[model samples]
Target: MNKQKLLIILAFFSIYFVWGSTYLFNKIAVSELPPLFLAAIRFSMAGILILVIAKLLKKSIKITRQQFLNSTIAGFLFLVYGNGVFVWALKYVDTGFAALLASTQPLFVLFLLRLIDGKKMQKKSIIGVGLGLLGMYLLVSQKTIATSEGMVLGIFMMLSCVLSWSYGSVFVSKADLPKNFLVSTGYQMFISSVLLIFCSLAFKEDISTIKTISYKVQMAVVFLILFGSIVAFTAFNYLLKVVSPEKVSTSAYVNPVVALFLGWYFLDEKLTNQSIIATFVLLTGVYFITSRKRIAKQKVRPSQKT
Candidate 1:
């Protein structure tokens, strides 16, 4: 295989495994740590580590003010609202359910892009969006809809997380990002981490709670910081430069499968036949939506008659 193919494979493996495991890790970590506080520390540490390495390599850290402003918005949307609500929702929902809801982000992005950018949605993409939503409905309806106010609120919060992530993705594709993807991402993380810390403090999270958590939870947090944030994100950015954005975006589809499996195997979460059917429908939808544009672009032109 060529170098580009190898990088794509690496990217797939990174996102597939790392992100699949993050749901479980987030569930485990939040059991002991405050969700926002834990996220704050994880991203803050990762950002500092990236900056240190960039400085050592003499990489450019200077970005235009516009780029910095854009990064801040991306970070707030992607990290503060996206990841923050994700962690918060874990307190009320199972890992599998959270992953399932989060997987809807790509579908949301497709519709949002069509509306905001005036990109025409192909029939295939529309079909995909429909199937994905149907799958979500089936998945959620299988469970006795939680009647408790807290559970209802948690579900809405998770949906908000998905919307935030979807909006952030659209902005990332259109924003005036720095020339260096890594540097841009590093700055975003740094800013988001700071904001998360303040948010955590305002919510009155007790840092002392960390000491009471099991060692397994601590290890989970470490894994999230090292693999999920640092390694997986690095691979994602690398793949964006080499592959079509659509291809890289397929990770959204693949990740939920991994999360479901991990949740079942390690956490002993039950997956009903309905869940299996939903996965099939959702995957089929994602494949169609993501590939439709490429298929459209490849149509042969009509010959001119003389």
Candidate 2:
């Protein structure tokens, strides 16, 4: 209803749809481009675009040495480990299973937060997390991810990516980065770009001719850079600061529904009744986590009740 709440809601939509759709775009981009290099270039371009916007707005881009270090750490954690590995894993797994595996991110986040800081959660949230995990398993269990080699390795790698992303998401909250969130995000993306490019070169990933890549693929890459990196990612960072990390992690739950539907509609991937049921259950968990029931504060005289 209010502007702040409205903005938060809009932010949720940005990450929910924008980042969710990126799985489809990523499939397109990596079909031609080298996965690590593709991610490196995408984030690098997005980082520069964000910096330019920040400069145009006259936002302070200055930061302390510690902030820069923090950005570098987050950069490696989120982008290099989380996203780069994820893109590579996609080659070995189908879209349905990939999104479902990645959706375990919130569970990892919950465990990490509790393990690191002993942050206790309400029973409702724990229940939500449990139901989400079970629902995702049921959704993707029937899907075929075994058509490729290294299926077990792919599963481990995807789960590792989830942990990397979850930890990075939580760490940023305490990383003492720049006050200007955009500036901080720019630094992180830039730092990750450097690391990723280094890895790409180390692996000698061959880059094909731009002319060989289709126009649709190129546009998908551009969409990933602009919307996924700049808009949705910035919104995610904002959400982390304002909301609980567990709550922010609900993107994992919502993302699969979008990714699954888009995969079915565009790529002719299977859409099963089991998957539909999973979506409903996943969304219900997200609802439980994100929705806050307002409780009226009761004012009572001292003599009324103990």
Candidate 3:
């Protein structure tokens, strides 16, 4: 295979395996750390690391005013609300359940596109939506979840996170950004880190409590910053420009499987029969939604401050 092909394969592996495992790691870290503050630290450190790497590689860190504004918006949508808040909700929801809920992202993307751009859905897309909704209902309506404090709210917030992430995906495909993909990713992460710290403060999270993070949770945060934030996330953004967004979104199917398995094995989280069935249904729906034949490739402008 060519070098590009190898890079693509490696990138796909990063998003598939590394991103999938993040749910488990996030669950581990948030068990002790304040979620928003944890996210702030992770992103801030990762962002700085990426910029340093960019400097070593002689990549430009300069961005236009519009690019900066766009990066901030993308940061808010994708990181602050999509990821940081979602991690906060993890305190109330289990890792596997959160991952399963995230499986509905393609459904949200289709719906959002229809709403924003009046994009017509294909027949399979409609069926996918129906199955996605059914799976979500099954997953969320479990007696265990219903009785758990804050579980319902966590589910709702997770769904909102999916919506925000989907919209960010659509937006980034078209937005002008820094020419260097790594630089753009760094800007977004850095900007979102600032936003998340304010959010942590607004929610009255004790910033000084970082001092209290257990060694185990601290390690988990390190894993998240290194593998999840830097490797998997950069791979995701790179894939978005190289392939179709629909293709990149397929990571949703793989993530939950890894999460469910790791959560069950490592954390002793339960996997109910209903949850299993819901996973099957949700992934099947995702398959259908993304199963359309390949068409003309519209590269995502090779920049993703969007």
Candidate 4:
């Protein structure tokens, strides 16, 4: 029991902190490499590393045809469209604010769950979802999204990303994916890398120019491949199997604060007083929903006592 609890906490921490920091790293990487090319290379390297590690450990890397198809679908939804568009939009939007916008994911996931699999939501979840939407409104108004000429397009693209990722999150749970988490993630990344590279070619991003990329950006790519792709994403898949999707998705709430602080500290991005207040509201909403999960235990206890 203790070991299981420890694993859960570790997984939560990996997604919470590592994914949050990725915004800053991704922002840095996109500076020197085009977004699709950057993502393509990052996923390809990470995929190769994961496959190699699985092989060295003598783990079976084989999957059924259904599993391969499922993994590829998830790869397109989560990485190709979701992350790729978000990275492309980072050229115009601030990383902190982009994360804030992405935080709307859980709300989208709620409805998708309802629609896709008939998953019922509790009352507390409804209240939390409403609160999250309000925070999103306040967050966007306080930032460039309200008035910047180009922000409309960026925001639209980000909303599409939220939709894509949310659908992928829900669908992955139903798909017949590989049971070996590392092997599954490796396949997913490899599939996405292929599509992203094709996209880079279609867009005419000069792949040869990557040789001229700065050492700092290259280091950021390495960091993303290791921690962001391998550690955090694998932890996320594990959590999806063991926890409620709503609880697993709560990383959306914590991630914005981390990204916002890191952006302010490292990139010198502005964090207005209003944005801080909105952050509190956002996290409080997440608390209402995630915290309410405990009522299940209390209800179960009464029945057992009788």
Best by TM-score: 3
Q: 1-306, model 1: which lDDT tens digit per residue?
A: 998788778877987778778999998898889999888888898888887777787889899999999999988888888888678888887677777777777677777777887878778888988998898778777645455446667778888878878778777767887767668778988999999989999999997897788999989988988888888888876776676667666776778888889889998887889878988887778777767765333211100000
Report clashes for each candidate as comma-separated counts.
0, 0, 0, 0
lDDT of 3 by residue, 152-239 (tens): 9998998888888888877886899897878998999999999988999899987776788889888898899999888887787778
- Candidate 4: worst-modelled 10 consecutive residues by lDDT: 297-306
RMSD of 2: 8.1
What lDDT score belongs to each candidate, Candidate 1 first? 0.77, 0.74, 0.82, 0.78
Error of 3 at 59 (Å): 1.7
lDDT of 4 by residue, 1-306 (tens): 698899999999988888898989999988888999988988899999998988898889999999999999988988899888788888777877788777766667667767876867788888978888777777777545568777778878888888888788767767898877788878988999999999999999978869898899988998899998888877876787698765676676788878888999999998788787777776666666555663333211000000
Q: List the residue pairs that clash in candidate 4.
A: none
Model 4, which residues run further than 4 Å from truth? Answer: 1-13, 235-250, 292-306
Ranking, lDDT, top scorer first: 3, 4, 1, 2
Cα RMSD to the true fold for all candidates: 6.9, 8.1, 3.1, 6.4
TM-score of each: 0.90, 0.82, 0.91, 0.86
From the highest TM-score down, the ranking of the candidates is 3, 1, 4, 2
lDDT per residue for candidate 2 within 1-306, as digits (tens), equals: 999899899998987888788888888788888889888988899898998888998998999999999999988888898889888877766565577667665556666767987867667667767777777677546545345467667777888887888788678767788878779878888989999999998998886545588999899988998888888877886787687655565676678777888888887777678767877776676555433221011110000000
Please give the TM-score that candidate 3 achieves against the real structure: 0.91
Model 1 scores what on Cα lDDT? 0.77
Q: lDDT: which is higher, 1 or 4?
A: 4
